[model samples]
Target: MRQQLASMLREARHAAGMTIDQVAAHLLCSPAKISRMETGRRPASQRDVRDLCDHYSVDTEKREQMMALAQDGRRRSWWDEYELPRGYSNLIGMEAAASSMRDFKSSTINGLLQTEEYAREVISSYFLPANPALIDQLVAVRMERQRAVLRRDPLPDMQFVLDEAALRRVVGGPVVMEEQLGRLLAITSELPSATIQVLSLRRGAHAAMDTTFTVLDFPPGTPLKPVVHVEDVFGDMKLERQEDVDNARQVFQRAADAALSPGESRELLEEIRAQYEREQPPER
Candidate 1:
């Protein structure tokens, strides 16, 4: 929501042929303040929005529309209660509004599809010497995010392409993994708009071998650009440039092309689950 407002404001500013400094001068504010407003680093006040719209000579109807967007941007998301890192919160905001998404995971299950036990285990592993309360909060946030797939008015179309190694990684334990696999199957059955595919090891050394990323597509009426999100140990990065987004899109397509079909992927998942069940220890 904030991104949508920022994009529209930036576009209007550019169309007006006014420099940031010039806008700052007109509004009697520092250039940094103007920059933050256009980049969504800070909230834009109603008066500030009106002043900018007037300066840009935006039609009254469009100006009102932008103001409405600004108002919407002020509403807090449920994730806000978790006190997430800035980068994570920004990505969640974008994800909440995305109409479709393509995800590639090379190391582990995507957060959106993780079952509660799987998510708890993954979080515990990462935040070793973990705080139990914090771990619970993190798990809750992830579970809430899964609602995007189940959203009904206009369901989000989602495709996940996973490296086969991810399935074999053995998160939690055999029983936990078995449950996770079952959850994945349930998700596919319940959400027709969601798909899961596996890129077998046999398709060795493919593109995007070292990266895990997601590309989010928004509805057409807004000025929001398609964004590619990349996360690493350092932090998360949002790629908005046309070239970067295009490259990410192509990478996802290539990986998807190399993955097993949805039916085949489900069959493989079942086989893996059976292996886990067989390996489970007998009653003590």
Candidate 2:
């Protein structure tokens, strides 16, 4: 929200026909500092807002409002209380608001695509003597998040690259895994804006290793920069540095290049389903 407020403040300043250098001179700061504050690259300090109000002749009420917004923007989100297993509540919140997303998963179904059964099995393994009711609530939340995948108008364009190992993991036994793979194929086949690519084992020791990350890209010039979410043993982290984000983007491209085309991936999934069926005895 800080970033959002900064963008709004910058727009207001721009509309007033003021340049960053001019504002800097009026506030007795460098152009870079003004630029950072306006772009949300730097947090808006109380003094900075006060100085800007003095320079721009903003009314006391308006100045106080902006200061309050800046304060609220820096405060952590309330979702941190959920204590998500992978500590992905923050990332989920961001993804829920993104205009587009590029995800690379190396060892499991992307969270959005995991079947309820598969998800339950995965989460069950994570929490010992797990509370069934809590697991159900978490699953519901996960399912709620899946709504993003089905959104039609103004839906966030999604690009997913999954490693072959993810497909072969057998998360919830063959039947469950087969159903999950079929669901994945079906979604990609039906959603024109969604793309799914499977990175084959043949690619070997690629940029993605046994790791997963997502790059959430918003509209250009927005206060929030494209961020990379990296999931680790401890928790998930949001990476915002330009260089790191750029590197993640490059790695995603490489992984996508190595993955099977969408059409081929769907076909491969079907073949695996057939193999699973062949190994199972007839029902009664």
Candidate 3:
């Protein structure tokens, strides 16, 4: 909501033939503040929206619309309850609202598809020596996101291109990985718009081998720009420039082309699950 508001604010400013410096002078604020608000680095308050609307001589109805958007931008979202890094929290919120998403997961399942146990292990491993309570909170947040995935109105497009390496990597051990694969099957089945393609090890040295990222598209006719999320061991980042977004999409398409078909991916998943199942301890 904040992002959409930011875009609208920019468009309004552009339409009014005002420069950031001009607006800042009128509003008695620094040009940097105006720039941050327009770009969504800092959210614009309702008063700010009102002042801009008045300055632009916008119609009454349009002013109301911008005002409502500003209010919604300030509202707390579901992910705000937990003590989370702001970037990660924003990513979850954005993922939930995206109209479509293409995710290339190099090392693990997407958080929205992870089982509770799998999530716990992943979180605990990364934030080593974490308090037990924190791990529980993190896992709970992941599960909540999964529940939201099912309940979302007007289901979004979900495309996941998973590396076979991620599928084979033992996350929490044999049994855990086995159950995690089963959860993936179940969750993907539940999402009617979901598509999964597995990139086998045989398809070596692909275009996306060096990155794990997700590209998100917003609804048509909205001002929300498409975004690319690049994630790594260090952290995550949001790339909003059109060129960066286009480049990410091109890379994703190339990688997806070499991946297994949806049917083939499911077969591979089942085969790996059986392997893990067989590795389980024998009954006494």
> Please, what are the lDDT tens digits per residue for candidate 2 over residues 172-283?
6888887887789788877787899888888788888857999998767454568899976577777878899999999999889878898888888888777766666578
TM-score, prediction 3: 0.89
Pairs in clash, predicted candidate 2: none
Residue-wise C-alpha lDDT for candidate 3, range 1-284, written one tens digit per residue: 77778878888898999999999999999999998888666778999999999888888977888899899988877877788875676578677778999999888888878878888999898775678998889899889988886578888898999999999899888889999999878766777799988999999899999889999998886667789988776877988888999999999999999999988998899999999999998888
> By lDDT, highest first, what's the ranking?
1, 3, 2
- Of 2 and 3, the candidate ranking higher by TM-score: 3
lDDT of 2: 0.77
| 2 against 3, candidate with superior lDDT | 3
Which of the numbered candidates is closest to the native, going by highest lDDT? 1
Better of 1 and 3 by lDDT: 1
Off by over 4 Å in 1: 17-22
Clashing pairs for predicted structure model 3, backbone only:
none
Off by over 4 Å in 2: 1-87
lDDT for position 213 in model 1: 96
Q: Give all candidate RMSDs, comma-separated.
A: 1.9, 7.2, 2.5
